[model samples]
Target: MGRWEPNARMRLVRAAIDLCAEQGYEATTVAQVVERAGLTKATFFRHFPDKREVLFAGQEEHAALLTAGIGAAPEGVAPLDAVAAGLDALAASFSPEQHEFSARLTAAVAASPELQERDALKTVGLAAAMTAALADRGVPDPTSRLAAELGVLAVKQGFAAWADGDRDDAGALAGEMRTALESLRRAAATLG
Candidate 1:
């Protein structure tokens, strides 16, 4: 076979996902991941803290993007409007090329209860990060938290549709997210 190329991080991620899908998440190990990636154990550690982190690597970037998006909202925008803007900004960070990877990663996450718990924590962290950003802009309590949560819901809904092969229906991840946000608003309106 050809020599393994040296993109250790990507290779490790792919290997981990492959192993988890083939065997099982709980059955997979860091050693197996490294072996599949054609890399050393040290390389895996260099990239991720542990097996769980392989699937969660994007979370830090996600939080940062959400924070930046909320922070950049135009001054004095309504809380929900600010959240919508943030969702739009964050959604713009993804491209169609990422859809397949996201779908696979999400599937891997779904296969393991531990991974699901981590995903839940990450979701809460994203909401907290967004809330902090909104609060920084003087968004009041309840408003900040509520708006941040709404944005998180929009993200979840959008990504679910996007990763579930709705690419043709939504056009793009950002568009899907915006559609989700609008749907949330409409639903909330009816509750009043």
Candidate 2:
């Protein structure tokens, strides 16, 4: 835990989650997080604006991945299919180490209303990113929004299942997400 260690951002995130889980999100402070990370306040600020943000540091990156994935879809691809590609990209960014982190994060968020609100906002932000990406591809209004919603739902459901299931099988998050998306599609079809 040197001052200039690599993966400083991840260190801070893990420290924050650990502290929040041990104590409470409301009880945790930036000072404690930085201290736990063996990093300075400046380093903490460099990675996150505040303690709350440490829990959500990947928001923008995840959005970017989703946007790029959707944008990279083949021309004339269906909206949901584009969303699936985006989800795949997002899921690919996760690593096995993140499995425990995700489980801790879920518990931390569940225990705190503030963290829950931030988590909800994160979901909305991701959905909006997907919606905008789909719209850019000439998808119409409700369709774009609906597909985005489905993508978010898939991500949530998939992540929960992955986090709760066997850690050794954590790599199945992407498949779980895709499965959720397909299930949603099938359920929607039944409405027709």
Residues 34-138, candidate 1: write the lDDT tens digits: 888888887789889999999777788888888887778789888777777777777776765467567777788888899999989999999999899999999
- Candidate 2 residue-wise lDDT, 16-120, digit = tens: 999988998999999999899899999988877878999988899999999999999999999999999998899889888788788899999999998899999
Q: Estimate each model's TM-score.
A: 0.88, 0.95
lDDT minimum window of 10 residues, candidate 2: 164-173
Find the candidate with the highest lDDT and give its number: 2
Backbone clashes (count) for model 2: 0
Write down the TM-score for model 2: 0.95
CA lDDT of every candidate: 0.81, 0.91
